[model samples]
Target chain A: MKYLPLIWAGIWRKRSRAILMLLQIASAFVLFGVLQGLDTGVSQTIAKQHGDRLYVSSSVAMGDPLPIGLLARIQSVPGIEYVTPRADFDGSYQKLDQFVPVVAGDVDSFFKVYEELKTSPAAIRALRNDRSGAIVGILTMRKYGWRIGDHIVLTSGLPTSNGSHDWGFDIVGTYDTPDQPTSATALITNFTYLNESRLTGRDHADMFVTKIDSAADADRIGLAIDNAFANSSNETHTQSEAELAAAQLQQLGDLDFIVHGIIGAVFFAVLFATGALMMQSLRERVPELAVLKTVGFTDRRVMALILAESVTFCLVAAGIGLALSTLLLPLARQQIGFSRVPDIVFAEGAACAVVLAFVSGWIPASRGSRLQVVDALAGR
Target chain B: MSFLDQTFALTATALRSMSGRRGAALVTVIGVTTVVGVLISLLALSNGARALGGSEASPDEAVVLGSGAASSQQSVLTRDEALAVRNAPGIKRAPDGTLYLSATTMVSVDAIRSNGKRGSVALVGFTPAIRLFAPGVKLIAGRMYRPGVHELIVSDPLRKMYRGLELGDHITLRGTEWTVVGIAAGNGTVNDSILRADADTVMSAFGRNTYQQVIVELTSPAAFDTFKSWALSNPALPVQVKTEAADFDDTFGQLHRLLDFVAYFIGGVMASGAICGALNSLYASVDARRRELATLRAIGFGGGPIIASVLIEGMLLALPGAFLGAAAAWLLFNGHVLSTEGLIFTLTVTPGLLVVSVSWALAMGLIGASLPALRAARVPVAVALRAT
Candidate 1:
């Protein structure tokens, strides 16, 4: 504890070299913080998702349309709270760049199944009464400067029974999910309106979302639901929200391999740089280290001091980098749809910094401790 | 000495004494190698994506889509509209006088990957003239799928990637069984990840009466404007017309742009860190020669020569790292196949990428050596000489 000043002095003995090394290590940590933060943040969000919600889709493929007739059968499964049919279509409003995803479903049961989406009861009633009325997500509503009672026409890929590509909807209300703003980008409308109008895939839904009664019975209930449709034409595979999200992410192809590869390359270069710098500085301070040994500092104490310097240097640099990433995460929040960098990233970064310091400083610290006073004083 | 001569002399001296500071110099070499290796490898990935879109695109072909459709997948053209586009002016005619026009639509079919994971692949329905429109697409195995038959020809890359795509394998979609009749090579373009079948057969099986898009080969690249104007001016056809180049760009631009952004962002951060390492190493190199530099300054050597010499040494140090890194990246990742959003591309380490790696390495060397060079040039001759 009393030797902190000595270690600090050793680090700053050449201020320019120290500062440059700090910046180098700090930039590596910046990448570490951002990438690791993104990875952990996504996994944590998936883990914290409502385990009681299950998505039932075609067992054959992900996007294959499932029959809405199966909705009744799924609802009759044991431990089911609420079931709603969902079908999403792509639409563009006014400009091709302004993309709006429309989710066609029963709003009454849909909102009940997805309780996180907050909306006024009056708005839900209005959406139910008006067949052609639509409830826009708060984010999408704000993007196009939409208001209630405004008639907006969207061009969809799917053609209607009347052979028109454009579909008009009266804006009934806006819904938002505070915890996840990106989820608030969907425009919700009645499935019956869509089903009766669209030319293809009528009476079919993309999936059936259900809320289960208990988290522990989710797998059992999902199995029961799948069992009923086991031999049917449109066989269903039910998955909890977490499992579904994980599978979808997995389809993006092994992000762990990429993140690990990049971080490995970064640490490899930094490790060499740190080791070289420590050795270079230690060589220049040999005479001084010998003088310290003569002044009654133990050989072990000298080793500890060198190790202490590297640890403090790496930890401080990593801390700054992690802090920088934390500040920059909000800018990525909109793009990646994550709330923030997870706190676990900082802990992980600190742990990595300690290992980095220990490995890089090992040889230099050992050489300093094993130095003979007679050879060191003689400038050998 | 002349400034040029002085610079040469100073560089020679620094290079000669580099062995004394082997550890520091190694740091710079390793740092630059890592930076350039990472940069080149990622750039190669984006290059592969560009190749995916650019390989089969030609300026002498045009795409017609339903008006206001954001993408071909969304566009819907009726039989009349498709016929009208076939008779449009400026379309190329084969020797048999048949127009080189094809109308196509696609249905998304999920295929099990070789690893037992689900991957969505497109099953495209093409008109008979598709062979004329895309002559670059040719059979690699078995025979071409006959029109009016429920047969599929899967792209070679897709056959290797997904199961149930081999020749003679039957794939059932929505209760209809379709046989795979052939394997085709799509010239490393977007078509490499799709299955092809007859337009009429696919439409009937999928209950679709409309074609999504119509593509026509123009007589010449200059004829594109004429074809576009004719398609847009006619009231009978509510369609959008774009040259094949523009269509490809619009289809694959987002993926390429994202890949480029990620490559450069990661490359930039890594380069900055590597430059810092170079700077520290160069500083140590100069510090090791403080007494010698002071003696040279005392003998009337100009500051410019010292700066130029340090910069030269830095670049020289970084050059080998560049080649080594590029070689590593090429050996490890070049020709590696990756699929994104159902499109397959090979990682290409082209000669142009070598130029990119070398330039980045030299820049790191120059920027890293600047401050250290100044410190060396402005060394206090009397003080340095007296202290050391």
Candidate 2:
């Protein structure tokens, strides 16, 4: 620790070069912080599952609707507590650019199943009393600047009974889930209104969410529900909400592969660039290193000093980069209209920075340690 | 000395000096290569995806959608509307004298991927005359599906992705089984993500009473405006008309823009780091050569030659790096197929992308060399010589 001043002096010997190296390392880490945050956010979203809730959909494909009649059969299962069916309205406000997914279900049962969504008592009462009333997530409200009691007309992709594709509903409530802020993008309306209004596919839902009494009963209930519809025209596939999320992620594409590929390329480049710069800096300082050895500094101490110099450069720069990314991510998320992007994971980034420092500093540090005083002094 | 003579002398000196510091020069080259390579590869990915979406529709074809519907998935037209569109003036007739129109029904169905996960795949039902409308499509294996039969022709790429899609294999849709009759290739277009079947069979199976959209080939590209005006003004059929290219742009334009933004943003961040690394290396090189350069200046060599030599050396180092990085991207990612939201695109490392990458590397060399070269030019000959 006493050699801190010496290490600092060595780094500052060429102030411009040191600053340049700092900027290089900092920029790389900024990229790292932002990319890693996005990668982890996606994986975590897919991994997060409500233990007691099960998602039941058709075995055929995601777009295929399940018969609403299955709601009663699923509720009949022993472990099932409450069940709610949601049909995807796939509506957009005004234009395609303003797409806001609206799920239709019985308002009361929907709220009972998704207890995480926090809302006012009056809002809940409004949704139940008015057939055309809708509830939106806080993020969605913020996105479009919507207010309570405002009527928002959405154009449905699917045709309705009146041969018109426009559907209007009063925004009666705005809900938020403190634990899962990403859920703030959801907009829910009464399925009874949808069923009565849509011309075709009236008695069906895109999926059903069931609440189970016990977490341990998830497997058995899932199996029983699937078995009951095994031979039916529309076969059902039931899985825990986590498994469903994972499956949906798979449908979205192989995000893990793409993310890893880009990150790998980036780290490889940074490692080589930093290592080269360190090698050049140390090679130039060999004579000085030898002089320190002649003045009673041990070989190990010289190595330690060089290593400390490189590590300081990397870590300090990385710290700045991470801070910058953390500050920028929320604004980026809001602009992009993606609510699920988690904040930067600091521990993972710090660990990566440490590893980067060690790797980039290793060869140069060893070279500095192995220098012979007489040979280095003679400029050989 | 003349300009050509001066440049040649500087180039010779730069080459000789760089050989002595090969390791440092190599590092700078590698850094520049990494930046350019990553930028090109990511741009290629976006280009490939955009090409897949944009090339599906031709300028000669017009699509009729319900007003305000952005995509066929959102558009619906009854049989009467389809008939009216088919008979609209300026629509070309097929070789068999029938109107060159294909009324398609688009539906999304659950299918099992080869990896054992289920995902949505677009199931499109088109008449046999679709072969005339999309002439670029050809059977890669087996024969085409027979009209009115519960038969399907799967795209070659889609077959590779999904299970039970091989020729003669059975896939159940809406409780009825359809046999895969052929594997078709759409020359890297969006059709490669769809399963083609007869319109009546698909509609009956999925319980749809209307066609999603009608695609018609105009008599000439100029005929589109006339055909569109007639369709919109016709009292019987109220529909919207757009060129196939315009429809595709509306559908996938946002996704393309997002991909491009991400690629450029990340690339810009990495490039800044690489540029700094290049600058540091060049500055150090010039500092190491200060005494030698000052000696040349003492003998009447001009500052212009010294500056030009450093700049030329920077460009030389970056050139090889650009090539190496571009070669690596091509070797690793070219033709690499990836799927997103059921759409498949193959990363294409084209000659055009390689040119773009090399240009970026050249720009890096210019900027990286400028400050160091200026510093070298300003070095006082007496002080530089006396220091060592």
lDDT of 2 by residue, B1-388 (tens): 8656776787787688887777778777878877877777787788777877654566789889865465766787877778877668898887669888889998888788888877788899986668786564688899888887899899988898889899999987667889999989755667778898889888888777788899889989999999999998986565779998888787677667877888888878888887888898889788888887788788877888888878887888889878998898898888777777877777778888878888888888888899999998888999999995
Write the residue-wise lDDT of candidate 1 on B1-388 in tens digits: 8999999999999999999888888999999998888888888888888887766578798999886678777787887789988778899999999898999988777788888877778889999887886555688888888888899999988998898889999987766789999999756677887899999998887666788899999999999999999988997677889988888887788778988887888889888999999998998889889999999998999999999999999999998889989998999899887775667887889999899989999999999999999999998999999994
Q: Give the TM-score of candidate 1.
A: 0.95
Candidate 1 per-residue lDDT over residues A233-277, each given as its tens digit? 677779999888776676666667777878899999999999988
- What lDDT tens digits, residue by residue, belong to model 2 across residues A169-247? 8999999998776657878899988888976777989899888998788899999999998877878888898877777
Task: Compute each candidate's TM-score over C-alphas.
Answer: 0.95, 0.95
RMSD of 1: 2.1
Candidate achieving the largest lDDT: 1
- Candidate 1, residue B355: CA error in Å? 0.8
DockQ of 2: 0.60
Which candidate comes out best when scored by TM-score? Answer: 1
Q: Which runs of model 2 end up more than 4 angstroms from their true locations?
A: A142-145, A334-344, B54-56, B234-238
